[model samples]
Target: MNNAVTIVRVSLNDANTLLELSRKTFFDAFLSTNNPADMEAYASTAFTLPKFQFELINPNSAFYFALVDNEIAGYIKLNYVDAQTELQDPDALEIERIYVLNDFQGQQIGKQLINLAIQTAVDKNLKYIWLGVWEHNTKAIKFYRSKGFEQFGSHPFMLGSDKQTDILMKKEL
Candidate 1:
């Protein structure tokens, strides 16, 4: 398989595809480590077509698909200002989500997406780029740390009714 990656902005027309990808990647990344009921509950609300449609049209939010060999390998979601899940700082960019399929992991796709987020922040003259990762997701935490992010705080993330804590990390531009 080819490893050449392309990042394309997601549009309203891609909502269905994005929804499916979002659900699939979310489950693929967390199902094994979480309660199935929790996963389903979260996915039911978070990965809906209607929700994605709204997000796709939000001026302060953006989505990008990471394609490899013309295949949708993964995707990223970025938010600004009030669109951010937390902080809502006008001068910061929020990485709401970034996920790759199990088959596509370890191919630098996530890295590319992170780089794009950094560049996007720089281009906007943003103060920093931030994200929330599950406190138990050490792999993701390590990845973010490697990209120059440092933990500054945490917030509650309700996955179904689990009420999980997420470590908030940020990379100042």
Candidate 2:
């Protein structure tokens, strides 16, 4: 694929494509490390078209897709204010999700998506950006640290019936 990647804001019209990509990337990233039943259960509820459509239209949230040569390679979801999954701090932005296709993992698309989130927070004068990374996702933790994030706390994340811990990390803008 081309090294040049572009980020585009996701709209209601793109819900189907977004849902497909979301399910694919999420499964690719975590399925092997998680129970099949738990993964399927979570995906069934989380990746539905109606769910994606609702998210796309939410005023306090935004989604963006990374395109490599016009093909969808990844996506990022940002939540602000009351829409944040945790903390709900008005001055902070929460990166609710960020995933790249397995085929595109080694590329810098993930970094570009993160930079976009940072810029968005800065543009809005937000004090910081935060996200929850699965405790076992060491690669992601390292990536966030390289971008100046530090672990603040952790919270339980329910992957279907499985209770998992997610390390909360934050970076001040």
Candidate 3:
């Protein structure tokens, strides 16, 4: 692929597209490692258009789409302050979600999306960037570590009815 990847800030108008991309990327990443019923249950509440609309308009939350040849290849969601799922630290930003389409993996799309998140935190004078990754997601854990993130803690995560642990990792700016 040519180096035509562009990152654009998402808005309410992209809700439908975001919904579909979110569902597709999410399932593509986790379907094989998770129970189908559990995945369906989580997607039922997480992948709805209405939910996307609500998240899209949140002042403390932001979303960006990584496009290649004008087609979305990935997306990232960020949360600040009270919008953060757990830490809620005023001096930090939370990377709530970052996923690249299966067809677009290994093209540095995920790396670029993460670099954007890190720059955003730096631009805002945030002290650090943080995120949660499933303990079972070793590939993601390694990726984060390579990006200068280190595990500082962990928390329980609910994927449908399955209670799992998420390693909380952070990169200090």
Question: What C-alpha lDDT do the candidate models reach, one value each?
Answer: 0.94, 0.95, 0.94
Please give, for residues 1-173, the per-residue lDDT of candidate 3 as tens digits.
Answer: 55778999999999999999999988999999999898999999989998889999999999999999898999999999999999799999999999999888888999999999999999999999999999999988999998999999999988899999999999999
**Alpha-carbon TM-score of each model against the true structure:** 0.97, 0.97, 0.97
- Cα lDDT tens digits for candidate 1, 55-140: 99999999999998799999999999999988999999999999989999988999999999999999999999999999999989
Q: Which ten residues in a row have the lowest lDDT in candidate 3?
A: 1-10
Off by over 4 Å in 1: none
How well does candidate 1 score on lDDT at residue 52?
91
TM-score computed on alpha carbons, candidate 2 = 0.97
Angstrom error of the Cα, residue 144, model 1: value is 0.4
**lDDT of candidate 2 over 12-120, digit per residue (tens):** 9999999999898888889899999999999999899999999999999999999988999999999999999889999999999999998888799999999999999
RMSD of each: 1.1, 1.1, 1.0
